[model samples]
Target: MKKLNKNQVYGFIAIAVLSLGVVGCKATSSVEKTEDKTVPEMFAGATKDTLNSGVISWKTYFKDAYLQSLIETALKNNQELNITMQEIEISKSEIKARNGEYLPFVGVGAGASVDKVARFTNIGAMEATTEIKPGKEMPEPLKDFKLGVYANWEIDIWKKLRNGKKAAVNRYLSSVEGKNFMVTNLVAEIANSYYELLALDNQLEIINQNIEIQSNALEIVKIQKDAARVTELAVKKFEAEVFKTKSLQFEVLQKIVETENRINFLVGRYPQHVDRSTGTFNDMVPNVVSAGIPSQLLSNRPDIRQAEFELAASKLDVKSAKARFYPSLGISAGIGYRAFDPGYLFKPESLLYSIAGDLMAPLINRNAIKASYNTANAKQIQAVYKYEQTILNSYIEVANQVSKISNLEKSYSLRTKQVEALTNSVSISNELFRSARADYMEVLLTQRDALESKFDLVDTKMQQLNAMVNIYRALGGGWN
Candidate 1:
């Protein structure tokens, strides 16, 4: 046997150490750009002393029992929301896969194979001359059987696999926030539609009452014509007005049907009557909303939080991609039994085992890795932009709803007085016409104005309620 001398052995060790140092020096870049994290102290000049409505639970926020029920049903059954839940599950599975990438993978397996060699080959001639035992010849064909447990693992020296798993975790949390945002919207939609249905019911009742009033006026005009106090044209005008009111009643009924169906759709059910308080629509007042500081939106709004998670995930993805440019160390091992025949597979003489490791690095044609790293960086930037946009949008939505609620309150008050005056005028005009003290045209106009004012009052009230629901949603309520 030959062996190396001490000097040669020292030189070999030095070369091995230099080789490790060269391979361990990664070429990946670690430069990351800064992101904006600024937010206003207040939203639409709101004071910081007020409490944010978003922290309130949906059950406490929505006082209407029917509306609360609808929201609950939607959260449980809405197709879009269910789909978002599935996406969350998928993200969770991705986390598992990434975690597995950095952990040892172990498995057991068994296999059998047969091999044949030609007599004219070198191995065939040697086999013909060989003897397995003193008087036995080697077999013409070989049969192999094996059974083993094997394992492979990639050492995450640079935290690449760990970062990938963290990214998946972030994405999973983002999906949860996405579902919460959807809940907010769904609750708002159902409430809005429910209020609209109530408004339509009120409008329909108003139209029907107006139609009866016009019919009586028509009767009076016909009586006046019979007495030669008015011409046929006046009677015909009153009759046409009655027909118009009846037609309007049908239109309002159609709206009611559509609104009910819309609510049913939101609740993920078939079209049917939506339970609501139709008579109380006029008495329904908008809920008082308190706007907290704009900075609170970071924690209050689900979309904002979702964007935040997505940004975090993207940042982690960039780290994982950058790590790809460095060398990766992998180890594999197997313990097994192998023999030329199945009878000998489990014997101690057939026992076999092996272990190996490799260090791999991109030394040539690294365009693919560079592109992936660049793409990860770009996505991180995009996530930052999206995060900022979500915050901006949340602030604007709350501000707009706040203004809308204030304006609607004033408008509704004015409309109430207008309705009262027109209603009185309607009665006065009818009495004057009956006594031949006012023109038939004046009576008709007063009745029409009064009916319209009543409808407007209902519509304004509906707007007030809708504004309240929207503000709650904007503040990220109904998702807790």
Candidate 2:
């Protein structure tokens, strides 16, 4: 073999290094363009600076033990969330598939063929195949046996393969963020439902208590009627009021069952009892939220992060498409031994080898390349706007939740006072009915007002609870 001249060795090394640099640049560019978009304004809030208290851990965030258990169970079994887990697995497989393209494809092939040609054909009349054995001579038109290994690779001069691989990687990461966003929404939903269940329980208990109060008033009226302090009409009216309370109690009970089922569905379980604490909902406190700087939201919110990844992936696809317009280089080689006899297959003289390099660029039929490039550009623009829209959405969500948290807290507190006053009126009006100073009409109105106040109080409490849940979700909690 002739030794390569010094200049030839240097040229070869330069080409190799240049090819490697091209591949590296394509991979690096995929995710780096995200820095171009403007930062968004964070949700409207009193605190523009975020309180980066240690990251939220659900175990610690939910001090309520029952709530913690419910959340843990939901994470394990929630159907939609579990399905997203499978989607992430699919994305990971896609990444592997794309990454594989940068490397060579190797395969082996084996074949044996025998054929008889017609004597009328020109080649058939001139040639015949023969095999020599110890005691036998084989004659045929031709019988060939072949075995070989082959490999093919595209030298990524324009880094199309590497860019495609990076795009796959970005998409995989986007899927993960998508799952996280789902997780945040899921946790918020469960928390909201849990709070509603508690509110329902509280309302039911209030109804039962009011029933007892109304029943006592009815008994008093009956006694007064027998003693001639009031007429039988008053007793009938009081009795009706007591019956109405009983009816409402059943309505609340039905609500409790339905709420249980709703929660059961979310937890991915059969309709069954949900362990709960029906303690005073009045004691509930809305979790405080600091609507961190808009920039921080870019990282904290999974939806935003997912959008960023998709944007990065789109840009990479554009680069890959553009690369199609550039020249592509490929190299392949094959080395093996072949012979008519199996014994001679490995002999040096029987060796057959081939190597080739190719450079190709689209010349006439570049419509495909043009179409791809145009589509990639369109998609890249779409991703840019989508990324911007996500930022806007995140900001709006945080702002709305913050307003809800503040306004609802104030509204809930005032409602608590309204309920307190109405509750006292119910007691005073009933006591007066027994003394004949207040009539059945007054008693009935007061009873109705008290019940309404209780319902309103529960509704307000639900809002406060929901605000807390929403604020947490808006701040990008629960994924961790």
Candidate 3:
């Protein structure tokens, strides 16, 4: 083969460089550049204290031992949490796969083949005339044997492969943050359900007490009817009131069962009795929640952090996709031994080796690359919007909970007073009915009102507890 002269080599190099210049220009389009919105300095109508309750550990924030145990079990056994953990592992594997793409690929192999040529052909005519030895001609059909190691590497001059690996790394981090977000929700759910169970227990107890009170009043009406002081209609009204109050206990009991099963499902266990202390449910006070500053949510909330990581990954994806329009340099090399006879494969004369490099760019039919570039840009924008939305939602949630807690406090206080007044009125109504001054309907109404007020107080306390847990979750607590 004739070798190229210096001028020809230089000319070839110049042409190749020119071709790269023509092909490497990237497809351009407009994309919006956005920055995340700054959160408020403080939550709406909230204190400026920087003591964020979200920083508190779940074990420390939840003082109940039983609740802590349930949360611990769920963290270890919850099905959704376990599934999320596997997703994180899958993301990590993707990072490894992407990382490997930026590095060299190597392999070793062996192969055998047989080839034959017609004597009439030009290369076949030469082969028949040539002699491998003084009297021996080349074989008519040749057997080939080869063993070799080969390597390929793509030079990342444009950082395309590196950017892809970086994107994968960011996605892996996003998956981890997603797991943490799930943990926050799981902890909050179990705590809320636990409180609901306590509230149901208290409501049931109140129903049973009301039933006893109504039954005693019914006995009084029966005695009065026998004494000719009241009609049988009054006696029937008292009995019906007692039966109605008794039925309420069954409704509350069913709710208790369903609630317990919900909690059991979250804890990743079969339905069973949840161990709890119901006697102090009324006395249990909600923990003081700190909203801290709205700005803290960016770092504290897992969903926000997850979205941030996803946004970062999407930006890298755009870079990687954009780089696809640039020239890529690849090198491949092989070293091996080949021989017509298996016994001669290891001989020095049978050795062979080759190396080559190629530089390529998409010169035509680049619609796929353009589509990918546009899709990447769109995703990046989507990620930006998602990040902003998560932050806004988190801030609003905390604000709403802060306002709810304050209103519930006032409502609980008022309801407590109302319950006390109604309890006294029920007793007074009974006294007046015995003296024939008040009607049986008034006594029944007073008893019903007092019972309802007590139930409302329990529900209010449950809501207050739920708000506390919710705010903690909104602030991105519990995962730590």
Candidate 4:
């Protein structure tokens, strides 16, 4: 065995002392472990069907071809969706940047410089007297040239760099989930707006029909006034009813234009007539909705998943921050050749190489490290609360929609019967007025009631369709 040199023994002692210092250093303050709230097993007042509509493809769930086409266009061209896609790409770039931090950086470099020293100085006097050969002297006004490969690396002894990279990976996944959540919302908004446009079309049709009926009643009133069976006031009342109904049609027409424009905006284009089947608007029945178990929402809802990922990333951030209190290790090295003249640069006599290691720990003025650690802990807690809130919000939305669907179904059925009775009453009142058995006011009242009832029926059906779309959104459907 060879004997140990004093320099080597001293170097080992210095490393031991630094390692001890690292072990002795304590975090300024300890952080509490993060805890997340649990989700409910079942929704309130909901049957556990185990078959969530959220898993169904949007194309299959929404059978209307026009609506399907609109959603497809929005997914590709909607400005908001496109913007989120760019955010995802940005997050991807962050992941790459983080991944590069823990790895060694190696590069090559070359440089040239000229230097001169006074003759009275120590180096100048030595150069003047030194001989390169039997009669040769050192060169004056020296020109130095050098080339070398160099490397620098931070040793991740406490996993700080790796944790940062993992956190970035989680954030990238969170951004993707954010895009999925947007898709779900965009699809629902377009669908609800499409249904609203159809309702307006139906309302316009109803107004036109009512106008014709009122005009005919006005004519009958004129005949009665000629026969002296009714006064001129009765004729005027019928004429006013016809005018009012005619005005309503224009209002509905304006709404149709506005709703169509809204759909066009969502489709990322200029306003144009939206293609839809108004003929089936009244005949269309809302599909049955089934809400699966509440626990399934954790996996079904993209917002919830997004929050979960953010929580994971925040936890990793806390670990990375805490590592700041510990010692860091780094290594740097370079090897090449240099000489006064370029011709001697590659010679063995001119060879040069150096390597070194650094060990550092935060021993004083560590308030910044402490603050960063505390901030990371706070963000982790915030993420936990956000995760729980998303789950709760998803459950509440599904519950409300389920309740609304049941109530709206009952309301629609009753409104249909009311419309039927009011429609028949209009005919009865007209016949009685012609026979002088009912007052003129009675006929006008019956017509007004019938029109209002029919309007209510259409409005109820629209609400039913809207509830269906909203529940699908709340359950996190449409993204897939």
TM-score of each: 0.93, 0.86, 0.96, 0.94
Model 1 misplacement above 4 A: 1-31, 133-136
Candidate 1 TM-score, true structure as reference? 0.93
**What digit string (tens of lDDT, one per residue) describes model 1 on residues 255-284?**
888888888777789988888774567998
Q: Compared with the true structure, what per-residue lDDT tens digits does model 4 show for residues 1-480?
A: 999999999999788767757653687565555655576777777886799988999999999999999999999899989999999999999999998899998999898998898999999999899987879888888789998899999999889999999999999999999999999999999999999999998998889889888888899999999999999999999988998898888889999999999999999999998999757577998878788888888898999999999999999999899898888889999999888889999999889999999878887788898899999998988888888888888889999999999999999999999999999999999999999999999999999999999999999999999999999999889999
The predicted structure with the larger TM-score, 2 or 4, is 4
Error of 1 at 227 (Å): 1.8
Full ranking by TM-score:
3, 4, 1, 2
Query: Over the full model, what C-alpha lDDT does candidate 1 score relative to the true structure?
Result: 0.86
Once model 4 is optimally superposed onto the true structure by TM-score, how far is the C-alpha of residue 450 displaced, in angstroms?
A: 1.8
**Best-to-worst ranking by lDDT:** 3, 4, 1, 2
Clashes (candidate 2) = 0
Residue 459 accuracy (lDDT) in model 1:
90
Which candidate should be chosen as best, given TM-score against the real structure? Answer: 3
The residue pairs found clashing in candidate 4 are none
Segments in model 3 whose C-alpha atoms lie over 4 Å from true places: 1-4, 116-126
In candidate 4, stretches whose alpha carbon ends up further than 4 angstroms from where it belongs are: 1-24, 130-134
What's model 4's lDDT at 471? 92
User: What range of 10 consecutive residues in model 3 has the weakest lDDT sum?
Assistant: 21-30
Better lDDT candidate (1, 4): 4
Residue pairs in clash, model 2:
none
Question: How many residue pairs clash in all the candidates, one count each?
Answer: 0, 0, 0, 0
For 1-480, candidate 2 gives per-residue lDDT tens digits of 999999999999778756644543332222222434456444455565667311486676667898888888989999999999999999999989988887987877766677777866786665533335455444564566667777788888778999999999999999999999998888888888899889988888888888888887788778878899888888888788888888888888898899889888888999999998867887877666566776777788899999999998998899898787666778787766665556656777777777787766665656676777777888888888889888888777777877887888788889889989988998898778767788878988998898998899889888888877787787788889
